[model samples]
Target chain A: MNHLFFQINPLEGFFFGSGKAMVVAGVAIIILIGLGLWLFRMESRLQRLNDALDQRLNDAQNQPS
Target chain B: MIQRSWKIGGLALLGYVLCMIFFVPLGPGLLEFTSTGSAGHVQDQDRKVTVYALTGFGTHWTESPDQLTVVLRHGTQLASLPLIETLDATHVLVGMDLPYTVPSKSWDVLVTHPVDGTLLLENGVFLQDRFIDEQTKWANPEIAEYPAELPFHFPYQPQILETIRNLMLHVPMWFTMFLLMGISFVASIRQLSTAHDLHQDTKAEASVQIGLLFGALGLVTGSLWARYTWGAWWVDDPQLNGALVTVLVYAGYLVLRATIQNIRLRARLSSVYNLFAFVILIILLMVLPRFSESLHPGKGGNPGFNSYDLDSSLRAVFYPAVLGWMMLGTWMYHVRLKASSIERKLRQLQ
Candidate 1:
């Protein structure tokens, strides 16, 4: 059609209409990234807990039972 | 042994989901098309109407213009129009020689391709004339049937289109969330019966934490999907509101656990709250939505995964996606449970 320009209107080009697939993919990626951060935090917490447990065990042994 | 089984099962199902989701090609079908003039309207005089076609695949119409024919069909009646000339991979221009007036009603397009073997696009073309009901006399009562042995793929719904692919990601998140919350509910019941056992409390907490993660993912994905399809990020639909409320209730459960000073009291109180929240979660997500009107399909007397929306082709990948996500959530819960147990042992050493 004569009047049909490229339908890119602002950010709608990236998120709306046929661009919906990209939006969904972005959401999936964000979820994975969030989970990755959660895992990293959990690992750090576990490491600290393990270190505390080891220190307590060592302290009890040094105190002669 | 149980931990090893969990790891193996979770990994296997996740792999299955990844393989099936990416490897399966989208089915070939007409997505949409619009002419320079309004759809379904016949011009009073002769004019050049440029047809723009949006097909899933370009291979169907890559052939020379002579090989493909665009025909208008109404009931048993059929009229073949001339292709005005320009032919691209997915578009065509048809010069209409309207000898007689075609009344206003929805018309179908039959694209006869040498390779595609008479591919049909229902409601493909519309011819709107002033005389509305007069066109029914020329209507074709015969329905066009698709080839039975087509490859496995999701159906192309008008509003959803390519976003139908999100069905695998978004819907499965909610399903998995519900599953994890269900596990948490069971664990809470066990904790109460066992007089707030530490292990059961840890398991319940882990399940709820992972379940909340999945629930949050579902909400974000659903919101984005609604933005494109329903023209808004959030709507006042019962199913959506119910999900938001359920997640908030679970958040309160976490807050309650954190505030209580005594371990046993925290376990007992949180377990009771979790039981209440799970009941509300079920009522909000499942029961209440069904009883009220909602835009979400399969809810409020809407036809859901019936013979229509979720066709056999979709069910192939959908079932595995649901299973894979549920298993993955369980794996996350197991990891959290392991961490909690390690913390408890550390406390004992202290």
Candidate 2:
């Protein structure tokens, strides 16, 4: 077998496996989630502002004028 | 109200479950194999390959002139495997493909020093998808005409398997998004004919939101698929290009509404524009496929859902997935509409 001068190379198995795809999907998930959270916080802040304005308007209207 | 809420909630729950279902058994082989030429099976005649020596694995020579390196691996551990060919000073040449009928569910192979019986190489696997393969015998001077392309190899790629998961997550999102957009398109038509401002607004807002969602999901899912299948995040496939352009057009619809102050004109224009969009959507997605080519299935490539694309295991989840996602999208539209109108009133008050 030594005199024959043989060569054996292994096969390359997988290229562009799903790992990279998952990473992209993960990023998209994070982005969507962050946007959702920001929308929620914005809604809360707007509600607070609306409430304060209503309170101020009520006070002015109730003033003895 | 409670009943409606329950219905919507139920629908949403179903959609979430559907999206989350990669758990269902996707056919037999947990480690699926696909090959070049003959798929997973090896052919006769072209047998024998040269590769880096596995110092101590069992080597099997097939009658078909194919070389096979059988690594009897069990789970994650690499144990000792029988090696028929003796490893000389020149390094061992194990065949690239071998037939193994595993009666059990596990096995391993390892390299050890025969003298001290010490294990030298325990287990370290590095198998990349190489461009030039054993079939390139013709390219070499000595064996340029060697007709042996043994062991048509496919990998137990987790990503490809995970891509099978896309049958659940990715497809449903687009389906749901499209459903939402279609609803918005219909509403826009009614609003246009009736001149009901509320209906018009609903149509406009819903279309924009759902269209945006579809665009975003399509972009994200597609990028993920490309990363795995095509080895790129984006490609210039005609179908994808059309989809992307359509998405941008819808986005422009939003921007168009925002910039214009004339309420009536914006409403009217956007409605008409949406109708045009629906037309373009059909043309780009369905009609043009007769003339163009696309890698995506529905567009042009292997166009129908058959055994190759949608197997029975896939159908079990896939059909339900569409229904679930559509219901969820409708619920999202309603909830989002309530929120949108409330915000609008608030803005007017301010």
Candidate 3:
């Protein structure tokens, strides 16, 4: 097989490599996780409020008066 | 039961997204392939000759330096060269002897790590003089054949490197945002046509609200990616500005909904405004950014320029990421819709 011909240059760029790239990923993941948890808690709270409302409505219907 | 199914599908998608994103292997390839000198220093058979080769970080190099092998390929001819030493995770010293004339000028350096497999550094090193006269071009016999069943991995990119994985998270957020907003646009159209169904308006509101959340995520992640890669948290790029404007337009829709006193008036006005905003959103986010000069790829001269191009191995993970996030966004929109309905019922009781 013919050897592929392409230019290979030496790596150069100071401190602009994998470490900083990972940091960007880390911060983004943190934000997504935090926001997801917040949304989960909010949904749970809303569910509880809706259940309470339903219970109150049921009790009022059962009153003799 | 239908609602329950939606939740199940959404949860399943979320699980799949997490597994694919985290578990894929990087595969055996060159993390970094570079030579210390432009042309390998001239070799004198009588004296010790050494040149440096640097590998990228995260290269699997657990084996001792002796276990590593470096081969030089000139056309079809192959020569196994000795490494003087391993400097660190990134550097190696290669010693070459010109016993035979190198067949071609385009010589390649092949580094075989004990476990990392073979990385071919092509066209970087050269011989000082021509020794061999015959043209002996053939495949290098020394290159190691890797196992066929290597686990799936994100493709290694020259500039992005590890951050290439970020494509799964950052790019998908925009896809999810676009899908959710598209749904919202349809719901607003329904609100206008129907006899002002409160349910449709609520659904539209909920979709935009969740879509905004995803848009916010896209912007933040994109900004972070730019900060590391482009060396800035924010740039005057059209795509970035377009995304911001789309999010703000949706936000304005929410504010408009909040301020109105009359229910019919609010629903009517908001739906009309939503239709206009959705059009502007499409124009700004989709159409305008493609034509302008932007650092983002797939724009102005960079046709599929970035690693996110259609043929990328990232598509395996990225398509699923988009589907999963869109599913999650839909699930959130549904939850918000139900919550709003419940609130309305409770208000009636008051």
Task: Give me the candidate number with maximum lDDT.
Answer: 1
Q: What is candidate 2's CA lDDT for residue B35?
A: 22
Instruction: Tell me the whole-model lDDT of each prediction, alpha carbons only.
Output: 0.69, 0.50, 0.68
Docking class of 3: incorrect
How many backbone overlaps does candidate 3 show? 3
**Model 2 residue B106 distance off true place after TM-score fit, in angstroms:** 31
- The TM-score obtained by model 2 is 0.54
DockQ of each: 0.18, 0.06, 0.12
After superposition, candidate 2 runs with Cα above 4 Å error: A1-65, B1-22, B25-159, B298-308, B346-350
Interface RMSD of each: 6.8, 11.7, 7.9
| Deviation of model 3 at B37, angstroms | 7.2
For candidate 3 chain B, the 10 contiguous residues with the lowest summed lDDT are B37-46
Best by DockQ, which number? 1
Model with the higher lDDT, candidate 1 or 3: 1
lDDT of 2 by residue, B91-169 (tens): 3333335323222332233322322122223223333332423322211111111222223212122225335656555
- TM-score order of candidates, top first: 1, 3, 2
Which parts of model 3 have CA positions greater than 4 angstroms off? A1-65, B23-50, B60-90, B94-150, B300-313, B348-350
lDDT of 1: 0.69
Tens digits of per-residue lDDT for model 2, A8-60: 21111121222343454456556544644554455556556657666766776
lDDT of 1 by residue, B1-350 (tens): 77456555655565555555544555445545455553322235355443444342323566555766666776667766666544455556665443356654677777666545465678886665324554444533333443523456555455665467678879889989888988989988899999835889889999999999999999998998898679899999988999899999999999999999899998889999999998998788878877887788786554234446777778877887788778778767876887887877777675
